[model samples]
Structure formats: C-alpha cells, structure tokens
Target: MNLFDYTRADTLGAAVGAEGALLAGGTNLLDLMKIGVATPSRLVDVTRLPLTRIEEHEGGGLRIGAMVRNADLARHPQVLARFPAVAEALLSGASAQLRNAASTGGNVMQSTRCPYFMDPLSPCNRREPGTGCSAIGGETRNHAILGWTTGCIATHPSDLCVALAAFDAVVEIAGPSGTREVPMATFHPLPDANGVAPALAAGEIITHIRLPDPGGMARHARYVKLRERTSFAFAIVSAAAGVEVAQGRIVNARLALGGVAARPWRCLDAEAALLGQPPTEDAFARAAEQALEAAAPSGDNAAKIVLARRIAVRALSLAAAGTPDRMPALPASVFEGDVHG
Candidate 1:
C-alpha cells in the first residue's frame, strides 16, 4: 500500500492550505484509495471544521455547509419543503448508512472522471496524460451518450448534483487565495471544456453549497433516475426537473440530467422550450427532444440516448404535477407519480 500523511484540520484555512486530498466523509475517497485510483501523499481531514451549519441564505434560500451529512440535508425541514428534488436525489443514492456518513460536498466531488472507473489496473488518459481512454474501445453499454471526446467518455455519477445543477446551486470554495463561489453547473468540468484530470482544483476545498431561492419551482420539482436496482445503484439515466406554472402556462423551467455526461447535463434549450407552454406531456416531449439534441452515442451506448430522452419527459411531467405532500418511499420509481410520461 502507498504511504500517506494524515492530518485532522481544525480550521477551514488549515484544510484549504493543506496540499492534498481533502477528506470529508471519505465514502468515495477511501474506496478509491484502497483500489489505487487515488494516491495522494497527504490526506487532509476536514470533518471537524465548523462548516456543518444549514442556514437561510440572503436570497430566501438555504446556504448548506459542505460538511453537512447527506441524510441531514435530505431531512432538513426547509430542504424537504422548498427543494424536494434535492432531497429526493439524496434519498435515492446508496443506502441509509452510506447517506448518514457521506458529506454534501463529498457527494458532488465523488462524481466519476472516467467511464471506466473503479478499476485501477486500467490505463486512463485522463489519469495519466496521453495514455488514452480505455473505455473508448472497451465496455460502453453504461458509458456516455453525450459530451464525450476521443480522450474520455466519462459520466458524472452524482444524483445530488443533478438536482443542484437544475436549481442553480453555488459551491463555496476556500483556498490559500481565499473563498469564492461557483455555480454547481460549472463546478465540475464540461464535456467541451478543458477540465482537470482530477475533479477539484489543487489546494481548494469546498466549504458550502449555496442554493438559490427556488421560487415557484420549489413546489413543483422532481428527481428521477433509472437504475438497475431500486437502491444503492448508480443511474443509467437520471433527470431533475422543476417548472413554474401560472394560469396554466409555464413561466420558468429548469432541467438537468446525470449519468450521461462529465457534468450534470443542464438543458438550457429544454428549459427555453418549456417556457410559455402549458404543462402537458406534449410540451415535455418537445423539451425532451431539445435536451437530447446535442447528444450522440460515444460507442455502443446508443440506447442511453433514448432512455435519457424518456426520463427527461418523465421528470418534467412529474414536476408539473407538483411535489408530493411527503417524499415517496421509493424515489425514482415509476409507481410513485401520477403521470409516468
């Protein structure tokens, strides 16, 4: 095993200034380290820092500290009432025990950088420059169908990020230079952008996640994922959708997809399509078409393109139906909503 120094950071500054992997809950980091996928020489433990508060933001939204556990955030009264999609995304991930131990920031950071991850023995062009993406010619039934390049056909696996991206969540990051905020949509690398091989910038640590006021969309939002199993599984295709309907017309809409791209696939065109339209299956189908307009199969995963489109429509239809009085016992289940789309 590779040797590494371990330090428990007592302050946010100490965690930022430390030059290595920032350990929050260590749910994904520890697993990656054990498999030799991550070999940081130093582990900066940031769990004890005073970054666990969940408070109301100035914009009438919630400012969630990075260290807040997934379970806590999902169950927070404000989160459940105002941002049910975010809560549903959290509840759909892993299991009760894993959610209890996983941090909000860690879940965003845990998104995969390569399609062929979890196998350290495989060579990765993203991990080591010019090595070439192994998944390019290998198993791609579960790989990307959008925003993939010859260098990588990676997929982001964060369910929280999909909901966060749809609602314009901002990531508050701290570093030697100081703290700054980035929208969750841009927090991770985009398919067409030059991105870090490793997800985070060097020496920077996420301190908080700032969610904007959901406004009308808060009452009508949903997160749905098509996973092989009912629980503890990654999405084959997932969608987070929110719409503001007034006088039987959509005034605003937000749509984002996961398990299809390097980052949560925000459907700006899809959002635009839904605007001024009645909240109906026909409108959602048009938006779904717009969402997948740029998508192309990287390899043999052409079916994901069809599945992605269907889920976008499903999520939008469910969002228009309004959030449930209580979260469904089975998130992302077809049986949970009135309209399956």
Candidate 2:
C-alpha cells in the first residue's frame, strides 16, 4: 500500500473523469500495485457508484452492472439457471471471499497473469513500452500460443471473461465520451503493433457487461477448468460452452477457451462443425479438433494443445448431453491429460 490519493466517485462520468487509475473491487489492481506491477498516482473508487445491478434486458439479454460482485452473480438463481456456464466459470475461480469482492467489470478488465509482466525486474514489453519482452525467449511455458506476436506471449487469465466471450457478451463502457457497448471479443485486444501490450486506452472505464439471453441454449451449458490448484489459482486451460439442441441434433453452439491465447479464444471453426450436427461425442470431438486447427503452443505448454482440445470436447459434450460434471472439491490437484483422437 503505497501512499496514493483516493476519490469516491458517485457517478460513471465522475468516476471516469476523476481517475489516475480506476479501482472497483481492488482485487486485481491493488494486488498489482502491492507487487509494484501497477503504480498509479491517484485512485478513483467506482465501487460506490450505483453500477451494481443485474437485470433482464428488454430483448431477452442480461445487463450486468460493473459493481455486481462475482459471488452474487455466480449465485444468482436466474444466472445459475439460465447461463450456468457464466455462473460456473465465476464460481470456479478464486475463493468465495474474493468473489464477494470482485466485480464483473473488474474481472473483465483484469490483467493477464504473466509472471514476467508482474515482475518489475523482469524484461516485459507490456510493463515497459520500449523494453524487450523476455517472455518471448525466456520462461514461456505458460505463455500464449494463439494470437501471439514475436514481441509478447502472455495469456489472458480470466475464466469469467472466457465465458463472456462464448456468450457474445458486450462490455458497456462509460468515459468522457458517454456510454457505449463493445463486444466482449473486441473489448480485450491482442498485443498491439508495438508487439508488447494490450490495447486499452486511457480515460475509458468498463461500466457494465451485457450478455445475450440464452434462447434454447440455456438448457445446456457448462464451464470447466484445469488449474494447478482448485482455488485461488489461474487456469492452465479452461472451456465454456453453450449448446442448443433440438431433438437429437444441435442447433446453435458456442465455445471459448482461456489460458490458451492472448484473449478469450473463441473456436469459430469448432463452433461451425457442431451446427446441424448430432449431439454426440464424435461430433464434439470433431468440433474440438477443428477449434485447435491453427493452435501454436509454446515451450513447456505444448501439453496445453492436448488439454485445451480435451477440455473443449468434454465441455461441449456435457452441454450437448444436458448434463454437466459436478464441480470438483478444492484445492484441486492438476492432472496430466491428452487431446489427440
């Protein structure tokens, strides 16, 4: 806790304007600051702003305010019943206490959990604009494979965000320019032309997230994660799936993966494979295979290629069958798995 000026903002406009840095739950930002990962001169507290709400949209979508706690969102009966994948991903991450404090907006805006990016002494382009990224050559076992550039290899680490991508949720941003919505896939950008960092600009704040209400897919959805530990750890690979089934055939399907790319990795090719196909293990496996068609795993993370595929297939299979696996007990030990057919 370094000495920093703090302001409590009561409105979105006030909060976005009064910021040196915006603090919601202070879960990610404060942690980064404590370890010298983030050192801002000022802090604007947005948690007090009336942004915490979860309501049904008129067009069958769900509007989630930025300040809504992760625990609250995960436990919301409507969310659990309708968008179980979203709730599952939220509950599967962190601990109950941390979830109670973490907000949907903060979680969406959370930084990548790259070790080099977090270490001040480490050479990371994201942390230092001109400094070279050591992760590209150094310890990159857990780094990104898809959407990675020669300059950076960090992977995004939000399970909730990955699910949001699958749901095609849009982030509601409020800043000096009023409020606008950006699709969740576009909300978090890949390492820019500079090759070392994300693309979020200054003065912009994520005010809320809007998820399209599940139609038939609400009946079948799941989120699965594989981590070093059950609780309080980032994912090695995770999957979120929403399957809409009619009779024995699949109608609509979506899939997203975390800890596998620069942002929430959507498997468009995999998704295309499931359209109009029978809801079977073979179909799910093919979809998973198509999803990883262009994957480029790095260093010790080569195993992620297999694990990502398996998780994707399993998640889709469960969703298609309308039966998800029970959440494993924590602290969960990681297991070695394969993805090849």
Candidate 3:
C-alpha cells in the first residue's frame, strides 16, 4: 500500500473538514487501496467520532449511528425486535470477522464487487469513466439485470441496503454546507449517463440512518439471500420483504431486491399487487412477476431473471408464514457468540 498520512477525528466537524478519503471501518476502503483501485494521500479516520450509538428515535422509530458496527446493530434488541429484516440482512452478509469491523455508513457506501472494476488492466467504466465497460459482454454472469446502462452493468453488493430500502430508511449527511436528510431510496443512485455510480458529494459525511417504525409489519418481514455458497459468498439473487396481513389478506407490503440492479430495486408495483390480496403462492408468484417485469437480462445473466423471481416468491411466502423455524439459517460459526448475540 502507498504511504499516506493518517489522522483520527474525534468530532464530525473535524472529520468532514479534513481532505482525502474518509475511513471508518477500513474493511472496504483498505481493500480497495491495496488493489490499486483507491489511493489517497491522506486518511481521515472517523471511527472515534460520536456516531456509534443505536438509539430510539423520537417517534417510535430507530436511529443508527454511522459508526455503529454491523455485528452490534444486527444483534441489538431494538433492531432485532423492531426490524428483524435488517438484522437478518446484516447477518447474511460477510463472515463474522468482517461484520465485527464493518460499519453502517461504510456498508452502504461499499463499491461494486465486480472483478473488472477491481482489475487495473480491465476497462471498467466505473473505475475510469470513459474507458468503456468490460462486464457488458465479458463475464456477465453476476452482473446487473435491471437499471443498467450500456456503459456499465455493475450491481451494488449490499444486503443491508436492500433491507433499508424496504423499510424506507432515511440517511443523515453532514458536509461543509451543513446537514441534509436523504431517503434511502434516493441515497444510492443508479449509474448516470457517464456510467459513474452515485456517491457522497465532495465533503459529505454520513451521520446516522433513520428507520421508520414498521408498525404491524414488524412481525412479518424477511430477508433471503441466495448466494453461490451457503456462507461467505455474495448474493446471486436476494429479496427483502415485509407485509401486513389482515384476515388472510395483505394490507400493506414492501419489497426490495438486490444483486440484480444498479441499486437496491424497490418493487412498488409488486407491493401494490399484493395489497388486499391473499398471501398465497399464486399471489406471491404474480407479485414476483410484477417485480421482474422491467428486468433486462444480458446473455449470460438471463438465468438471474428466473432466479430473482423465485427468490422473491419464496421470501414473500416465508414472511407471510410467520414461522421463525422456517427462516433461513445463519452460518454455524456465527452462532458461537463471536459476531451475533
């Protein structure tokens, strides 16, 4: 790694005021630096800033600090009780060691895990805007199937982001111009005409993530990630779903998909289809079809269209069943109390 000046900031103002890349957990940033994908002359360490708490919001919601570790938030009583989908999503991500070091802000801001984007010799539009995209026709098995431009077909690899989108979370940002609140749906924008993915502006720093109360849907939420392996693998297709059902009929529903879009893909059409309908296999199948209606799969990734639909139907079925025993299992090692409580 290249030599860089390092400074730890104890306050948000100091952290945002400093130049160069901001470091929180260094799980993704340091890895990118080592691979020559990211290089900074200086590193502003924001891990010590007072943003590590998970507290209750004023209106029965929850506020999670940017520095709050993934493992901590996943097991917190408030998160587990109020937003089980969030907890499940975090647990479904990287291994226990990684989860202990990853932070809420860093997790959401992580870059795509595309091989071409990480390879210096490869032509990746995300790495070098006008260089052209390698994933468009080369090794596209794991690339995006929705909201992709010809310049780039990369997908965001964040499990927590998909869950947050389903919950309609809000992001709090602090910068030189002061503070602003951005909805989670709008926080991670799709690639623009230039093919560059959206990112925090010049001096913006993530402060907190606010999750609205799920009300009755709190007890009926699920996050299902279908990866190549049962552990320590990125999702090939994943679904996060929450629904409020009354008298065997859905009242309110929220659905978001991952691993198939440039950003977390919220399915408003699917949610609308589920409302007032019975939560049956046929209903879930129709909702899943509605969700994937806009999918534009490439040659190698055409299988993902079917896989994403089946995963969505399964996730919705599990959420409607309300059976904890039937929920997907975490890794056996994670149960050792090392990462999760």
Candidate 4:
C-alpha cells in the first residue's frame, strides 16, 4: 500500500474541508487502498464526528447518521419495528464482522466489486475512465442488465441502497457549498450519455440519511436476495418490495432492484401497475413483466432478466401478505453457476 497521511476529524466541517478521501469505517476504502485500486495522498477519518446517532425525525420519519454502523442500524429497535425492509437489506449484506465495521454512508459510497475494477492491470472504465471496460466482453455474467453503456456496465453492490430507494429516502450532504439534500433515487448517477458521476460531488460528505414514514407498509415490506450461496455472497439479483393494501387491493407500492444496475433501480412502472390491483400471483407477475421492460441485458447476463422478474414477484407476494419476518430461500435452480465477487 502507498504511504499516506492520516487525520481524524472531530467535526463535519473539518472532515469535509480536508483534502483527501473521507474514511468512516475503512471497510471498503482500506480494501481498495491495499489492492492499489484507490491511492489517496491523505486519509480523513470521520468516524469520530457527531454522525453516529439514529433518531426519529420531526415528521415521523427517521434520520440516521451516516457514521452509524451497519450492524447497529440493522438491529435498532425502531428500524426493525418500522423499516423492516431496510433492516433486512442491511442484515443480508456482508458478514457479521464486516457489517459491524461498515458505516451507512460508506456502504453506499463503496466502489463496485467487479473483478476488472479491482485489478490494476484490467481495463475498467470505472477505475480509469477511457481505458474501456473489460467486463463488457469478458466474464460478464455478473454485470448489469439495465441502463448500461458501452463505456461501462458495472453494478452497485449495496443491499441497503435498494431498500432506501424503496422507502424514498433522502441523503443529507455537507460540502464546501454548504448543506443540501438529495433524494436517494437521484443520488446515484448512471454511467450513460449523462456521464459517470459520484453520488456526492468532490468535497461533499454525507451527514445523514432520511427515511420517510412507510405509512403502515413497514409490516408489509420484504427484501429478497438471490445469491450463488445462502450466505456471504453478493446478490445476483435482489428485490426490495413494500406495499400498502386495503380490502385485498394495493393502495401503494414501492419496488427497487439491486445487483442488476449501476444504482438501486426503482421500478416506478411496476409500482404504478400494482396500485388499485389485487395482490395476486397474476397481478404480481404482470407487474414484474412491466418492470423488466426497460432491461437492456448483455449476452451473458440475459438470464438476469428472467431471474429478476421471478424475484420481484416473490418479493412482492411476501410483502403483500405482511410476512416481512419470513426469509424466503432461493431454489438451487436459480443459481445457474453465476457467482458475484
């Protein structure tokens, strides 16, 4: 690893003003540093800043500090009792030890786990823009199936992001320009004609994440992850589904997909299809089909189109039945030998 200067910031202003990569838990940043994928001249430690609390907002929503550890957030009584899908998504990721060291802000800011991106010799546009993407024509089974360009097809590997999208969470940022709020759906940018951009601008720091009230859909929310293995594996395709039903018909629905796009892919069309419709297998299947209509799968990842639809239907069904506590197991047939890093 390259030698670098390190400083711990005791305040948000001090942390954001420092000229280096901000470090919270070092869960992802340190790994990237050791692999030579990220070489920072200095490290700004923000874990000591006053951003570790999880509190209820004035509007009945929740405000979670960016530095809050993943394990603590996942097991928080209010989070488990209200945003069950968020809790499930956080618990489904990584291992217990890693989760304990991963911060909420760091989780969303982590780089893609694509082998090409991590390997210094490989040509990955995300790692070095204009180098071209090796995953485009090499070992692409785990690549993206939606909103990808020839320049890059990498996917964000955050389970928490998918649930945040479903809940319509907002990101609170502090930067040189002062504080600002960005909706979670718009925070992560796609690498298309618009160009690749980090969720936060340079010198910007995430202070906290704001989650809107679920409106009684908390008990009717579910997160389903389909991975090569039951544990410690990144998802091949995952779904975060939340629905509010009345008299056997859906009143509101929120669906977000992960492990299949550059960011947490929100299925607004699917949600629209579910509203006012009965929460039946047929209805769920139709919504799933509508959700995948925009998919632009690469040759090797075409299977994701089918797999994502199946997972979406299953997740929605579980949510509609108000069984967020039940974890559904994926059948072996769904694996198809496509493992994620």
Candidate 5:
C-alpha cells in the first residue's frame, strides 16, 4: 500500500470532517489500495466512532450500526430471529476470519469484483472513465447478464446487500451537510445510458442501516447462492426471497437477484405477479419468468440468465416452505437442501 496519513476518530463529527477515505474493517479498502484501485492520501479510521450498536427501531425493526462486524451481526439474537435472511447472507460471505473483521458499512460500500477494474494495466471505464472497457469481449463468465451497458458489465459482489435490498432496508448517511436517509432500493443504482454506476458521495460515512420490520416475513425467508464452491467464493448467481402467505395465498413477496447486475436486481414485477397466488412450482416459475423478462446476456453469458432465473424460482420456493429452525450446516448452497425444488 502507498504511504498515507492516518488518524482515528472517536466522534461522528470528527470522522465526517476528517476527509480522505473512511476506514472501518479495512477488508476491502486495504485490498483496493494495494492493487492501486484506490489511492487515498489520508485514512480516517471510524472504528472508534460510536456506531457499533444494534438497537431496536421505533417501528419494531432494527437499527444496525455501521461498525458492527459481520460475524457479530450474523449471530446477534435479533438478526437471527427477525432478519434471518440477513444473518444467513452475512454468514455465507467470505470466511470466518474475514467476517470477524468486516463491517456492515464496509460490506455495503464494497466495489465490484470485476477483474478488469482490479488490474491497473487494464482499460476499465469504472477505474478510468473514457478509457474503454476490457471485459467487453473478454472473460465474462462472472460478469453481469442483466442491466449491463457496453461501457461496463461488472456485477456487484455483496451477499449482504442482496438480502438488504430484498427486505427494503434504509441507509443512514452522515457528511458535511448533516444526516440523510436513502432507501436501499436505489442506493446501488444500475448503469445509466452513460454507464456511470453506484451512488455514494465523496467523504460521506454510512452511519447505520435501518431495517424495517419484516412482520410476517420473518417466518418465511431464504437466500440461495450458486457458486463454484461450497464456501469462500463469490456467487455465480444468487437469490434472496421472502414470502408472506395468508390462508395459503401469497400476500407479500420480495425477490432480488445478486451477481447478476451492477446492483441487487429487485424484481418488483415478479413480486406483483406472485401476489394473491398460491406458493407452488407453477406460480414460482411464472414469477421467475417475469423477473428475467428484461434480462439479456451482455456477452457469452447466456447461461447465466438461465441459471439466475432458476435460482430465483428455487429461492422463492424455499422461502414459501418457511425458514429452517436452525441455519443449514452450509449456508445458502443449492446443495444445502434439494436443488431441484
């Protein structure tokens, strides 16, 4: 890593105005710096700030501090009981060692895992705009198959964000202009016509992530991930699903796809289709179809579109079945249960 000034801040005001890169767990920031993807002249450590509490929100939901570590949050009583999908997403991320150090804010702010953007030698528009995209006609097996532009086709790499988006979580931000809240749905935007992506102001610190009460959603939720391996691997395609059923009829449904686009691709259309329908193979298949109605391969990733749709159906089916009393021995694997659901 390059030489940079470092200071630890004990207060939110100090951390906000300290400028430079806001450092928390250093799980992603340090790696970006080592590879030249980030070159901050100063590092303001916010681990010392009072943003580590996981308190109950006014509306019977959760207010998760940004500094809460992944492992702790995953095992927290409230997270496990109320937002099991969120806990499952956290446990399925990285490894035990990295999870112990990674923070909630850091995970939400992580950059894309596209190799082209990581290589300083490559011409990546996300890294150096107007330089062109190297992944255009190159290796794209792990790239996006939905909502991608020719300028960039990198998929977001966050399991936590997928579950957060599906559940309608909100982000709390602090900066020179004071605090503001943003719905998680639009927090990570898809590439516009110009392919400019993501949404986070410079030097703004994510104070907390507020999760609204799931109500009936708590009893039925699941996050299913398809990867090259059982653990410690980024998803090839993943789905987060929550279902609320009344008298055998679907009342509320949430579906979001990860590792398929620049952000967690929430399927509002699919959710609408599932409303009032009974949770069954045919209904889930139809909803999955609506979810991928606009999806087209950005490159030679046509198979990803198929795989993502199947995962969506699989996730929704499992969620309708109801959450397991205990987390699976292996979190989120298709093999965790029957993949052919």
Candidate 6:
C-alpha cells in the first residue's frame, strides 16, 4: 500500500475533523489502495475509539456502535434474539477471520464489489467519472436487475445492509457537519440519469446504526442468501424479513432484497399485500410476486427471477413460523441454510 499519514482519533470530534479517507477495518480501503484503485494521502484510523459497544436501547431497540466487528455483532445475544436477519447476513459474509477484522461501520460503507469497477483497465463510470460502464455489455452476470441506468449496473454488495433496510434501521453519522441521522433506505444512492454514477458522498463516516424497536416482532425475523457456493461468496439474490402472524393472519411484514438491486430494496408492495392476508404458501407466493413486479432483469442473470422469488417466500414462511434457528434442509437448487442462525 502507498505511504499515508495515520492518526488514531481520541474523540469523535477529532476523528471527524482529522480528514482524508476515513479508515475503519481497512478491509475495502486498503485492498483498493494495494491494487492502485484507491490512493489516499492520509488514513484516519478510527477503530481505536470507544465506538465498539452494542447496547439495548429503550423500547426494545438496538444501538450498535460503528466499530463493532462483524463477528461480534453477528454473535451477540441481543442481535441473535432481536435481529436474526442482521446476524445471519453478517455471518454469511466472508470467513470468520475477515469478519473479525471488519467493523460494522466499515461494512456499511464498503464500495460496490463490481469486477470491472475494480479493474483499472476496464471502463467504469463509478471508478472514473464519465469514462463509461463496461458491465453494461460485458461480463454482467452479477450486475443489478432493478433501479439500473445506462451508466451504472453495479449492485450494492452488503448482505447486512439489506437486512438493515428490512428492519428500518437508521445510521447515525458524526462528521465535519455535526451529527445527523440517515435512514438506511436512503443511505445508498440509486442509479440516476445524471450519469455521474452511483455512490455515497465522500467524507461521511458512519458512527452508529439505530434500529427501531421491533415491538415484539423482531424475534421472528429471517435472512436468506443465495450464492454460487454454499458459503463465503457475494449473494446472487437475497431476502431479509421481519414478519409476524396473529390468528393465522399476517399482522405485519417487512422485506428487503439484495444482489438484484442497485441498493437495499424495500418491498413495500409485498408488505402491503401481506398486511391482512393469511400467511400461507400461496399468500407468500403472491407477496413475492408483488415485490418483484418492478424488477427488470437483464444480462445473464435472468434466473434471478425465480431465485429471488423463492428466497422471499421461504424467508417469510420461516419468519411466520417463528423459527429463527432451524428449517428443513434447503434444496440443492436453493441456498443451504448454514450461515443463518
């Protein structure tokens, strides 16, 4: 990696003020720098600060510090009991060793894992503004299917982010502008017409993710990720859900999808469809259909049409059954249920 000035901030203010590229785990940043994709004059390491605590907020919600490692968050009792989807996503990522090195804040801000964007030779608007996107007609099997524009088709790569959107988690940011809260849904940018490419703003450091009180319903959450391998690969299509059933009727349902969209996708149409309906196989199928109504599949990923639908249905079914721990073995055609706790 290129030489850069390193500083460990003593306080939040100091961390926010001493600027260059904000470094947490350096999982993504350092990797990019090593490959010459990102070269920074300075590296502000904030992991030493006291932001690693995970606490129970009032009203049964969760307040997670930005520096909490991915493994710690996934294994925490509070996360296991409350946000099973979030925990499952974290554990499903990388290996145990990488998770131990990855911080919660770093995961939230990790860049899109597009192959062409990272390769210096390829044309990518996200990497070099106005250069153009090579994924549009190149090896785009892993590109986005929804909310994509001509300029960018790269998908957001974080599974935990998808689950956060499902639970309506908001991020707390303390920066040069002072403290501000950003809803998870709006935290990632969507593909737009400007052709300026899609990405989060520079210099914004994530400090905490504020999880809204699940209100007795978080215990029944599920996360399902489909990948080429059984584990440790980015999702091909994933679903995260918070669902509750009362008297055989669906009382509440929240869903977020990943891999198929440019950002964490909240399935509002699916939520509306399941609000008063019975939580059954057919109901779940219909909800999945409604959720994917806006999907526009392209490139070699047309199979995602069926894959995404199945994950959504299965995740909702498991949530309605109130089983966060076990499920019937997933078929070979679908994902193996190993990473989800």
Which candidate ranks first by lDDT, i.e. highest?
5
Error of 2 at 96 (Å): 0.9
Candidate 6 has an lDDT of: 0.81
lDDT of each: 0.84, 0.81, 0.87, 0.86, 0.87, 0.81
Clashing pairs in 3: none
Compose the digit string of candidate 1's lDDT tens values, residues 130-239: 66677877888778887788777878889999999999999998878887888998778754323336546678888889998999988899999999999798999999
Candidate 6 structure quality by residue, lDDT tens digits, 48-106: 77787777688888888898888777877667767878888888888888898899988
> Once superposed on the true structure, which residue ranges of model 1 sit more than 4 Å away at CA?
111-115, 191-196, 327-341
Clashes of each: 0, 1, 0, 0, 0, 0
Each prediction's TM-score versus the true structure: 0.93, 0.92, 0.94, 0.94, 0.94, 0.91
Cα lDDT, model 1, residue 39: 89
* Candidate 6 TM-score, C-alpha based: 0.91
- Candidate 1 root-mean-square deviation in Å: 6.2
Give residue 38's error in model 4 in angstroms.
0.6
- Whichever of 4 and 6 has more lDDT, that candidate is 4
Model 3, 1-341: lDDT tens digits are 78899888898889885798989889999999998888899999998888877777877899888988898888777677778999999999999999999999999999999898999789888878888888777898999988888888888999999999999999999989889999887687777656875568887899999999998878789999999999998899999999889998999998999999778899999999998999899999999999999898754899999999999999899888772632343444443342322
